[model samples]
Target chain A: MTGPLLPDLDRPKAFAAPWEAQAFALVVKLHERGLFEWPEFAARLSAEIHAHPDQPYYVSWHEAAVELLVDKGLMEAGAFLDQARAVVRFRASDHHHVARLTPIAVDPARAG
Target chain B: MAGQHDDHDHDDHSHGDHSHEGHDHDHFHRIHSEEVDALLMSIADIEISARVKALEELLTQKGLVDPSALDAVVDLYENQIGPKNGARVIARAWADPVYKAWLLADPNAAIADLGFAGAQGENMVALENTADVHNVVVCTLCSCYPWPVLGLPPVWYKSMPYRTRIVRDPRSVLAEFGTVLPDSTEIRVWDSNSEVRYLVVPRRPEGTEGLDEAALAALVSRDSMIGVTEALSPEPA
Candidate 1:
C-alpha cells in the first residue's frame, strides 16, 4: 500500500492532468524501487526550486513534472527517457483508441 | 474575499527570535496558500481569474485536502507568476541614475547592490523599455523567474501552454493577458538561460517626475515586468 502514492486529485493543477499524473506515477514507482521516501522527495524538490531562485520557474514541460520524480529518487533518471520513447511509440499507432488508459510501460532495459 | 487580500502582510510575532535562521522558511510556507488564494482573488477582475477561482473552490472543499498544504502550491505560484526580481531591477534602473549606469555596465552588480542575491542573478542583463520598444522575458526551456523583488507569479504563467506559446509569438500571448500594444512598438524577447536571467525595466510614465521611489515602485506591476503591458498612470491624490 505504501508503493509510490499519487498526488491528491484536488491538486491537479500542480500536474497537467491524467496523462501527466500517469507519467508522475511511473516515476514514483521507479523511486519506490530505489527506496526514496515522500518526505525526501519533497525536500529535494524544494531544494531544487530554492537553489535556482533567480531562475525561479526553470522547469521545462517534460522535466518539470516527470523529471522531478526522477531527480528526487521517486524514479530512475534513465527510466524517464525510456518510458517517454515507449509512450510516443504507443501513441503513434492505433493503441491510443484501443487502450482504455495506456499503462506507462517502463523500459526494462532502462530500469535501474 | 477582501479579508484574504488584507491578510497579506500578516506576520506571527512568536517567531521573532528564530526568524532569520532558516526556520522561518517554513513559516512563509505555512501562510502561503492563503496568501495565494487572496492574491488570486484580489486580481480576479482579470480574464484568467475565473479559472483560478474554480481551482480555489475545488481545492478548498473540506476533507478533500489540507487547507494549509496549499502553502507549497502558493509558494510555487509565487515563483512563476509575477514581476520578478529581474523586473524590479529594471524599475530601479529607470528611477536611479546611478543604478541605471551600473545596470548598463554590469546588471549583476547593479542588482546585487539592491541586496537581492541569487546564483542566476550573478550574470544578468536588463533591457530598458522605451516608448518605441518593449521587452518580454521567457524561459522556453523551463520556468525560470526572478523571485527577489516580485512576490509571486500568477498561476497561468507557469502553464505549459503559456511557456510554449509565449516565446514563439509574444504579441499574441501578451494580448491574451490583456495587453494591446501598437504595432509600431518593437517587442524584444529575452530567452532566460541557466546562468543569466533578464528583467525588463519599463520607462516611467509621464507626469510623475515628482513621485518618490516608493510611489514609483508601487506603480510597477507583474505584467509590466513581463513586458506584456506598460506601467499606467499612478492613482490621483
Candidate 2:
C-alpha cells in the first residue's frame, strides 16, 4: 500500500512536462494549506483511479483536489465547471497559435 | 449512472443533462457524481494552471486558504530542497572511508547524522554499486521515496508504465535511459515494498584524484543516485 501499484525500473525525468510539475506543486501546496488531509486526498485519488484507470496519476490528483473542494463546499460547483470550460477554450487557442507559427515573408515593395 | 460514460472516450466525456436550466450555462454538462465528474474533467485536457489558479482564487476569496502560504510551500520543495542533499551525502561517503563504512552499516542513522532524516526516510538502506554490481530502486505499491535525501519523486517514478515495466526487465529499462552495463556486471533491482527506502551510491568515476569532496559532489547526477546512471568524470582544466 505504501508503494506504487505497479513496479518498474525505468528512471524517469524529474519533470516530463511543465504542467506535471505544476500539478505536483499545486497538490503539495494545497495539502500544506490545510485545505484537505493526505488520507482524504488519497482516498479521493483512489476513487478517481478506480473510476478511470487509464488517466495519468497527477491528473487524478488534480481532479481529486477539485472534487474535495466542491464536496467540502469550498468552491461553487457551477463556477468551477464554467472555469474549466473557459480553460479548455483558452488552451485550445494557445495550442493553435503555437502550432501555426510561420516565418514572416518580407515584402520587396516595403523594404527600405 | 457511473459506468454510463465508460463507452465514451475521456477527451469528450461531457454529458448533456438539463437539470439546472436556470443557471444559464446550458452548454456546461454537469455529471452529478463527484468521482466521475472529476475523472471526466481530468481527461478533458483542461489547462492545469488555469484550474489551479481558479481554485486558488476561489479558496483565497472564501478564506479557506492563503495564496502566499501555498506559494511558500511550493518554493520550499521546488527550489530549497532536492537531490543536492543526496549529492552531499554521496560526496561525504566518497571522501571519508569511516563515514562510508557507517553509511553502509546503518543508513538511517548515518543519514540522520547529516540531518537528512524525516517523513518517508525514517527507515532506509544504502546500496553501494561496485564494478561488478549495480543497484536500482523502485516502489511497486506506490512511490514511497526517500524524500529527505532525494527530494520529491519524479513524475515517471509514480507513473504506471514505470511501476509496471522496471521490475520485469531492469537491463532494458536502464538501457532506455542510455545506461548500458558490461555483461560481467550484475544488476540488482531493489523493491521498496515496506517502509524501508533504498538509496544507490554509485561508484566514483576515475580520473578525479585531485578533486575535493565538494567538486566530486558536483559531479553526481540525480540519475546516478537512483542507480540508472553513473557519476560524470571530472572535466580537464
Candidate 3:
C-alpha cells in the first residue's frame, strides 16, 4: 500500500469501488498463484503511481497488473483493448441512446 | 464498505421519466438534483473520490464517453459483470429446450437475446457438455474471450503453460483443474479466436430438475462456463 502519498492525506484510502478491490485482489491472487512476485508488482505499481500520481490509487493497481501481465505474456496487449472496448460497447455503442420504458422483449427465433 | 456512500445527499428524488428496464438500468438515478452533483463537482479541493469523479465527468463533458455508459461500465465491472451473465444464458438453455436448440444453432443470436453481446464476442459458439463428451475453451494464440459475459480471463487461463499445454494434453490439464471426466467420456478442447468466442454450457446438475432459472443460474460458476469444472450440484432436498 505504500507509495507516493499526498502530503495532506492523513489516513490511507479504502477501496471506493468494487473494481478497485478486484484490482487489489487480482494482484494479490496473481502473486499467490506465482504469476509474478510481490516485488515485481511493487515495482510496477511504484512506476505506475509515479507515472500517474494524480489518478486514483486503484487505477495504478489496475494498470500495474496490465503492465506486469502483458509483460509476462499472460495478457496480450490487444486483448486488453478488446476487453475494454467490448465493455464500453456492451453499454453504449454510441454516445447517445434512446431511453426505453420497458425491457426489449426477446424474440426467441432471432436475437443477434 | 461501498454501501457507506450513504452520506451523499439522498434528497431531491426525481423518478418521473425514469424506466426500470431502460437498457441503462440505473442511468437516471444520477439526477438527484444537479445541485448535489455540482457541489461534488466543485470540490476538487481534496478527497481522492472527488478527483476520481471529476475525471469521469471530464471524460463525459468531452463527449469521449457517455456518463450513463461510464457509470454502467464501472457498475458492471464492480458488481454486475461476471460469469453471472453467462450463467443466465446457461440457465436459460437448460430451462428451455427451444433456447438450447437455438443457442446451439446460432449462439450469438440466442446469447444476445439476453443482452450480452459486444466486441470480442461477435460470433459466439455454445459448446454443450454432455455425458458422452466434455467441452472446454481456450485461446492458444492469445486471450480471446467473450468479455461481455466472462469479463477477463483468469491468471492461469492466460499463462503460457495453459495456452500451450491444454491443446497437447487436455486430459492432464483438466485433471490439473481438478476436473476429471469419466474414462468413457470424450474430452474436447475448443480454441477461441478473435472472430469466435466459445462458452461451455456445463451439464445440468441432476437434482436441479425442479429449480427455476435463477436457482439454476446460482449453481453455474465461471469455471463451469469455461469448462474447467461442472455446475455446482443441487442442494439436498
Error of 3 at A65 (Å): 15
Enumerate the chain B TM-scores of all models.
Answer: 0.62, 0.66, 0.65
lDDT of 1 by residue, A1-112 (tens): 3434432222223332112222233334434455455655555445545665443121222234333544545445444333322222221221111111111111111112
Model 3, B1-237: lDDT tens digits are 121221111010111212111122122233343323333332221132222332333323434334333333333343433435888999999999999999999988898899975442147778888887788887654455665676545556655698778777777788888887677677777766545678899999998889999999899988899988989998897
Model 1 agreement with the true structure over B1-237: per-residue lDDT tens digits: 221211111111111222111111122333444343343333222112122222222323312233233333354343333335554566676678988988878877787887766442125666677767677776544344454444444445545577667766777777887776667766667755434556677778887788877677777777787666777678777
| Top-scoring candidate (DockQ) | 2
Which of candidates 2 and 3 is the stronger one according to TM-score?
Answer: 2
DockQ of 2: 0.06
- Which segments of candidate 1 are over 4 A away from where they belong? A1-112, B1-72, B75-88, B120-122
Taking the tens digit of each residue's C-alpha lDDT, what string does model 2 give over B166-230?
77777778888888877667787775533466788999999878889899999888778887788
lDDT of 2 by residue, A56-96 (tens): 66556668888887798777777876655543333222211
Q: For all candidates, state DockQ relative to the true structure.
A: 0.02, 0.06, 0.03
| Share of true Cα-Cα contacts across chains kept by each model | 0.00, 0.11, 0.00
Where model 2 places Cα greater than 4 Å from the true spot, the runs are A1-24, A27-112, B1-83
Cα lDDT, model 2, residue B110: 85
Candidate number that wins on lDDT, 1 or 2: 2
